[model samples]
Structure formats: structure tokens, C-alpha cells
Target chain A: MVNANITNKMRNLRDAYSSALIELGSKNEDVVVLDADLSLSTKTKRFGTVFPDRFFDMGIAEANMMGVAAGLAACGKIVFASTFAVFATGRSYDAIRQSIAYPELNVKIVATHAGISVGGDGASHQMLEDIALMRALPNMTVIAPADATEMEDVVPAIAEHSGPCYVRIGRADAPIIFETHGEFKIGRGLVLRDGSDVAIIATGTMTAEALKAYDLLKKEGIEACIVHMPTIKPIDKKLARKVAGKTGRIITCEEHTIIGGLGDAVSMAIAEKPVPMRRIGVNDVFGESGEARQLMEKYGLTAENMAKVAKEMIKKY
Target chain B: MHDKALIKDLKRKALEIRKWVIESVYRAGSGHPGGSLSIADVMACLYFHEMRHNPKDPKWPDRDRLVLSKGHAAPALYAALALAGYFPVEELKNLRKIGHFLQGHPCMKKVPGVDMSTGSLGHGLSVAVGMALAGKLDGKDYRVFVILGDGEVQEGQIWEAANSASHYKLDNIIAILDRNGLQIDGPTEEIMHVEPIAWRWQAFGWDVIEIDGHDIEEILDTFHEIKMNEKPTIIIANTIKGKGVSFMEGTLSFHGKPPSEEQYKKAMSELEQEERELNG
Candidate 1:
């Protein structure tokens, strides 16, 4: 049931991450967790409380935390290292690259407070390039879950899948989209709605916005297809081509920079058979301090912007 | 006290390790001879005497782990592994060759007996801490050993790892700081001062043990003394860069440069003379 106070049943993705972590810790004795002094914000403290011995607080040192995660994973422990996305990817990039990705160790880097949606923290705290940074590395599986339910499914999926992985979650509560539990795969896309006019491919919190856009387009007599892509690296090429062929126009939505996020990934995937597309995301610029909702609107990440872009693209192309 | 025969055997092993370091670097045409030669004695001690490892089963769960933090000294590590029977001694000649398993840096996936892959400086100790932490959690007696270059200590991640190792009370970690005094550009003091090195480790809550890294007996005794340590221990091994090789000893030029053909032959002959003396 959707909560009355929240519009369209919003839930914190971090809560889902921690609950899933606790569940994982219960099942596997080798499951270990590390945090870089952001245990409270990342909600890994829940897992820490339940399994004190398995949890490690590395104390404001992200590089050391990543390396420690790699070490634990080296000794056959399924390790998850958590921190804000900015520090997790930027501050500890080399550590993750050398210790985890190069060796192909089983360390899941779950970074919270990703994208401009980390409201009031401004550009410094916002991690708009994490997907770009992680996806560029070899043997890194990058995933940005759409909502709380998807985030819940993603934990076990990444844990089950071997080798290094990067999962990005946002700070603000996101609207819950997926109702029923479904088996989540690493490099697959979910088709929420199907139509003929145009396709809306979205990742992370932007998927919920795409859903809203679908309704808005329907009111304007513009039928739209919605595809939720959680995994960025090893993207679902088959689904991307199918949607590209089905609809001549596509719109990619994300809360990250338009440079190397979902938009670039989709374009690369469908480059063989070109399609007229629009990327609805933060342009190649830094974000300023503002409310998460207001930033989304100002940065053209709202459903209204998506609908407008889709209509314009259809008419122009 | 170690018996005379055992000490003699370890000394012979250390000499053989040094020979392998020179031979590998000579064949590779480019490798870190200075650092590798400096750590040869410690490597011999680790693979031959101290570590509880079975070369036949390198991935043995209970086996002690070693992380070569100053990975440029990979020639020394490969030589030690070869002598310990992890791989064929002939493979040492292929160091850094195209498609060779003996890479410019140590890769755990490619090589046997390598606990953690390290190349970029300041990364290995953190991984060692993790391994030590895992040992503590699993209640395994296996210790995690890391060898850090004095120059490598300039990386801030080393201190971060040192702090966590002490904060977590990981007594199972035994770090050997190869204070060989010379880095690539110049001496570490002139480059980046990591002096009061033992005091630095002590301040970080480690039980610091300073010794001549080349002294096989002192190295063995320090290992023995730390057997009952309740805190993480750092053995600040004062060593000479380019040790054993007459032309290269304590010289900055040989840090990452391979010896010339004549230099290689002369170095081998000197090591052979030492071997003959030791046998006599």
C-alpha cells in the first residue's frame, strides 16, 4: 500500500540496502561490511549492530576502506564497502582500480548519496561521474537501482554474481515503482510499459520520472514505451536494439551528467543502427545547493521535461 | 636460538635468492635490482623459515599471506617463490617479458604463492590489514605479512592502514619496512622524510622492532620475539640498497635499472665467491 503523506509511495533506497545486507549476513558467515565513517548515513550501521564482528568502520579513510574490502574479498569473504558516492569513487579510485578491479576480487562497492539528488550538499557531495568512472574500469559491474524494491533485489543479485561490482543509490527517498518481486539479473533491462510512438530508457531514480512521463505523454495522445535499465556496464544490447528498432526515437533519463551515464551507454549500444534520441539529465555542468525536487525540475529531470523532449524530438525528427 | 646448521641453510637460501634476483633482472633487461636485492634476505627468511606455507598448496586457507607492497621489488618475490618450489626456477628468467606470468608487478591471479596483487604504491598494506582482519574474524592462526618500501611509506594510505591495523588490534599482521634509504629520484630523506620511522610505527600503536634487514640471525630473532605480540608489529629493517652486488650497493642508479652484461657477470661471480666461502 502506498503511504498517503508520500506521493506515489516513496521509500529510502538505503534502508533497503541495509535490510538486504542484514539478510545476507544472516545467511553467509563470510559476508563482511566496511564503511568510511558514513555508516550512519549509508545505513550499514544496521548490519554492524546485527553482526558486529563482520562490520568494519575504517574512519574517514575511503582509500584504506576500499583496499581493506579488497583484502577481505581476497581471503574469500564477500565484502561490501560503503560510503558517499563522491568519496567512494573519487577519493579511492586507484585503490578500487588496483586492489579490487584489477584482481577481479569479489568486493561490492555500494555508494550512497549519488547524483544531484543529494540535495543541499552541492556539486562537491554530488557524484555525477561515478558511473563513468566505474564503467571505464575493467571487470567492474556498475548498477544503479531504480527504487527501494529494485535496490532490495540488487543486493543478492550482485552478491550471487562474482567479481567486483559498483552499486549507486541516491540520498533522497525515491518513488517505489516495481511492486512484485522479480529475479534481478546483472545485465538485463526491465520493460515497464510498451507503446509505439517513442521509447524512454531510464536508470536510477529517473525510471520513476519516465513512468510519470508515460502518463503525461498518454494525455497528449503520444504513446511511449518505458525501459528501466539498472545495469550500465555490459548493458542489455539486445533490448536496446529491439527498442531502437521498435521506436525510431528514444529518450534517456538520468540524475547524472549526460556525458558518460545511461545516455552515452545507450548511444554506444545502438550506434550501429542510429536513432534520433534526447538525453534528459543534468547537462555537462556542476550542481548548486538546492532541494532535491527543485534541482530535478531546474535541471530538466522532471516528467514534464521528459514529455516535452519526447514531443519535440518526434516533431523535429 | 636457531641451530648453526639451520642458520647456515637460511644464509645459503638468502644467497640463492639474491642470485635469482640478479639472474632474473639480467634476463628481463629492466627490473628493480636495488630494492629486490635489498629484500632478498627477508624473502628467504619468509619463504624458507618463518611463514607457515606449503608451496605445493599455495591457496591453502590456513597458510600465512604475504603482500609485497613495494611491488617493483617483484624480482625478489618471484625468486623466493621459485626457490620455495611454487614454480619452476627457469620461469624466473621470464620476468616482465611479453605474456610472462611474472609481470612488472606481482599479480595474485597470475602467480602462485602471491597472496595479494600489488603494483601501485601504498595499496598492499591495506589489503594486508584486511587479510589480517579476516584471520582474526575466522579465528585462524595464519598471519598476514606485508613488506613496505621506505619510499612507499610516503603514500598516505600506508598510514591509514597502519592506524586501522592498530585500532582493530590485529596482532596477526607483521609488516617488514624495507628501509633501504634510496628511492628512484634520491635518498628518501631528501625526497620525503619518513624518518623516526620506528617511533612513527610505535606512535601508531605497533610494537616496533628495528634490525639490520641483512642480518639473518637478527631477522630470525625478531620474528621469534614477535610470536607473542598482542599488537600489530612492524619490523623496521634497516637495509642497504643494491646490497651484495659490489658496483651497485647503496647506489640510486640501480633502483629500477638492469645491470649491464659485464656488471651482471661480475655480480654473479661475486655471489659465487660468497657461496664458496659460506660452504667452506
Candidate 2:
């Protein structure tokens, strides 16, 4: 169970993403934004309002929007395309794989409303396997920023990085966990707290909870180091190795399925290091209609759950 | 348009491209020779006559782009690109082979002259729309041409792309439908029935124009008269499934099959005769 006061610190990531895009648009004249008629929801309408000529509304056709983004990328434009994660990933995967990833085009697909935090939109809207699908592609840089401030940094990072990227964001508000001027790098992890008892490697919104869990674990005399992995594709293997060596025990966390996402990426890297690890995530199941806070409780995604899961894994090891 | 000598040369080139299509598919032991043979004449017109491109400078930003949406018919485009000096004509034999650039489907990254990578059905037109939109935004004079298989239009995404192209008023892009009326299963009409296909594009606000695809002069003249300053155009080219070789044309067998040794010999002989006739 959560303290209910965490919501006070939470801010909408979509609005942060919107401001980032406008900033990127001002700096780079070739930066273009596209939306599949969800600009209002996805917050790309900010960029559309500021740079009308550079912003294209694809009118709810996500697949076409993807191809158009690739085309703009092909023509040397840094394209930021947005929609819900479900439609951006599941609906137009072929376009992303073949047109964008295959060509290694400079298209930044910044999709919001990822994971069950999309809430009452139900099973169809909740995208749990997008990270797996996108990470499997050869050239796609898959990312899920922890909060609004992380998203602000991640947006320009992908724009500056010349290649196809899938930046997943949640609909629900999340606590800011990074500084405004913080230096963010792709394929690297940020250590929120240092400890030797265990490593809590988390991504997306789950990173915020993992930080809270770290505080709880510290109070219980279990020193768990928290590493916030923003970029999932180029999973920080060096960081994984360092953490595994230091702590020798690890628990991966995500707001996604345990299979082939942050869990799989971390496990595949830490496998060589051979640490005793247990992944805490949605145990390969679809989420149902519920409020974002209620879904987190029902799905065992709260800080209390993370601290509990960490204690059990420590006992087992 | 009245230069009979130029038309004669283009006809000979089409036949040559057709011969290479059969040779490459037969060598690879598997390819879609039916669809490849169908688009030879039109592809020849685009590559050698109508479009502005420089093979020596394939990455020229202003070069016209051609996306073969019906990418299973890659053997045809491969031959056309080779003939245009994009690559070696000898490399045609290595199509679909391990470590070969000439893949089973068109890959723009691997192939020299390919503007967009395409293989999945119904994606070419969208890419073409993207390229056309890019050209418009950048104020470039380059035109984007896309070829879609008759059956490929059955995909919902094609309609999605169609709606956007007209919505954006992409006057610099043109789509050609290889309306051969045949697919892997059987005739397109019997398979899924996408009839009134011309009117469908018209309904999408495209300038629909129907023409005989195999007529070189007609194809050339059609490109010369395109209204690229007004709206995106869709040329519904009525063509045979396999246009060149006698036994292959209009037959469903070659839709996805490479010729046997005997069939390959016969196909080559027929193409050789056509080449001689055009050379005269």
C-alpha cells in the first residue's frame, strides 16, 4: 500500500514531453513533429501550435504517420512522431521495423500512455510488450524515461542521436526523479542510491517506486542500490556488471511484462556476471480496466510491493 | 513523343530486362517472376526514359525516387537498376543468396538505386507519400513514384496512405497499380475481389488514369502528361500477370514460382526473339 502523499509530487510526463519538443524545435530547424490525431492527448499539439508548418497531423492513421516520419527522416529531418503506445507499437510495428529501424532512419517515436497506467482505457490500450517488440529490432533504441524531468532530457537525447528510437511514456503522473540540468546518456544507468546488500534495477515509472523501496529497505537495514535504467535496448551492460559484482544479488523491476523487456535485457547482461537475481514485474498477464493507482495496487506495482519482493528474494538467496 | 528510334531502343531495353528477370529468378531457384515480368515495360520507361536519375550518383538528393511496393517483383527492378548502371549486371545471379545485396525483397540500404526498402504488402505507397511530402516541404523538384501490386491494395494501410496523400495534396507523388488480377492463391477478383479499384482511388481524391502497362510509347506519353502540380495521381495500369513470355503471361503458375530448366529455356528463347524484333 502507498502512503497516498506520493501523488503530491507527481507531474504529467506528456506536458514535459511537449515542452521538450518545443525546445528541440526552436534549436533545430529540421526537427518536425507528427501525431495520429492524438496530439491533444499525447501533448504534441504544443509543437504543432508553435511550428505549424513543421507539425503534421496524420489524422489517426498511426501506420501512415510512421512511414511519413521515416520519409522525413530519410530527407534529413529529425522526426518526432507521437501517439498512444499501443497504437504506436502494436498497430504500426511493421512500419517501425521495416521503414524506420531497417533503414536506421532518424525517427524518434515518442509514444505516451504506455503500460497499465493508461487505466480505464482497458486491455486494448495498455501496452505491456512494446519494449520487448521494439528492443528485438536491430537498430531501434528503446527507452522509458522514469518521470517528467527524465523525459525532458531523453527527448533531446533521442533527437540528437541519429537513429530510430521508441520512447515510451505513461499517462498517469509520476514523481520527478532527475534534475533539470542532469546529464543523461543512452545505454547508461543512473544510480539513485548506493548499497551493497542488493541492486534494484528499474525502468520507466517503476524506477520511481524502486527509489521509494530503496528508502524502505534502508530503514530495514537492507542496503539496496537503485539503478534507473532509462534506455532499455542498449541496456547498460557495464552498469549491470558493476552492480552484480558489488551486490551479488539483483531484482529487476518494470511496469511491463517480465518477459523480454527490462527484465530480459538486464538478465541477458547480468547472466555473464552470474548474480542471484529475481525479476519483479507483471507476471506475463494482461491488465484489466482500473484506475492507475488501483491498477498499481492490484498489479503489485507499489513501493511496498517492491520492498516486500526485495526482502523475499534476499531471504531466498 | 514521336521519336520512333527512342521507342525502339526502350522496347529492346524492356526485353533485355525481362530476359534478366527470368535468368535471375531461375538462378535463385525461387522468386516472383510473374509479377516481375508484368512491370518490365513500365519500369523500363521510368528508369531509362522518363525519370531524372543518375546511377553514378545514386544518393543525389534531387534524384527522382522509385519505390516498388510490389517488392516481391524485385527481380524486375534489380534488372532495371543494373541496366541503368546502378550495379553490375552480373550480380543479378546472386539475388537472394547469402551475403548478397540483391535481396529477395527490395532493400534501399542494400541496393544502390532503391529509394525505399519495401517487401510487406501495401507499404510502398505510404513511403512514397513520405518522400513526396519531404520533397514538397524542402521545395525539391524530385518526383516520387511507387508501384503497388493489384492484390497489395487489399491491405487497409494502403487506403490509410491514400487518404493522407490526397489530404496533404501530394502532387509530386504518383502510384502505379500493376493490375494483373492475379495473386498467390488465384485471380485477385476471386481471392478478395478489389474491383472498381480505379474508382476507389478517385474516391480518395486521387487523379485516376487507366492505361495499357506494356505499351512503351503510351507509358512514356502518360508520364509526360502527368499533372504533378495539382494532385497525387494513381495510374491503374491494366497489365497481364506475366506479360512477356507466351506461356507465363496471364497464367497463375508463375506468380511465385521460378521456371524449371525446360521452362527457363523456352522463356529465354521467346525473350531473345522479342529482343531481335525490337533491335530491327
Per-residue alpha-carbon lDDT of model 1 for B146-176, expressed as tens digits?
A: 9999999999999999999999999999999
Per-prediction interface RMSD in Å: 0.5, 1.0
Q: Which one is best on DockQ? A: 1
Record all residue pairs in model 2 with backbone atoms less than 3 Å apart, i.e. clashing.
none
Runs of candidate 1 with Cα error greater than 4 angstroms are A1-7
TM per candidate: 0.98, 0.97
> How does model 2 fare in lDDT?
0.89
Report every candidate's CA lDDT. Answer: 0.92, 0.89
Q: What is the TM-score of chain A alone in each candidate?
A: 0.97, 0.96
Candidate 2 residue spans exceeding 4 A from truth: A1-8
Which 10-residue span in candidate 2 chain A carries the lowest summed lDDT?
Answer: A1-10
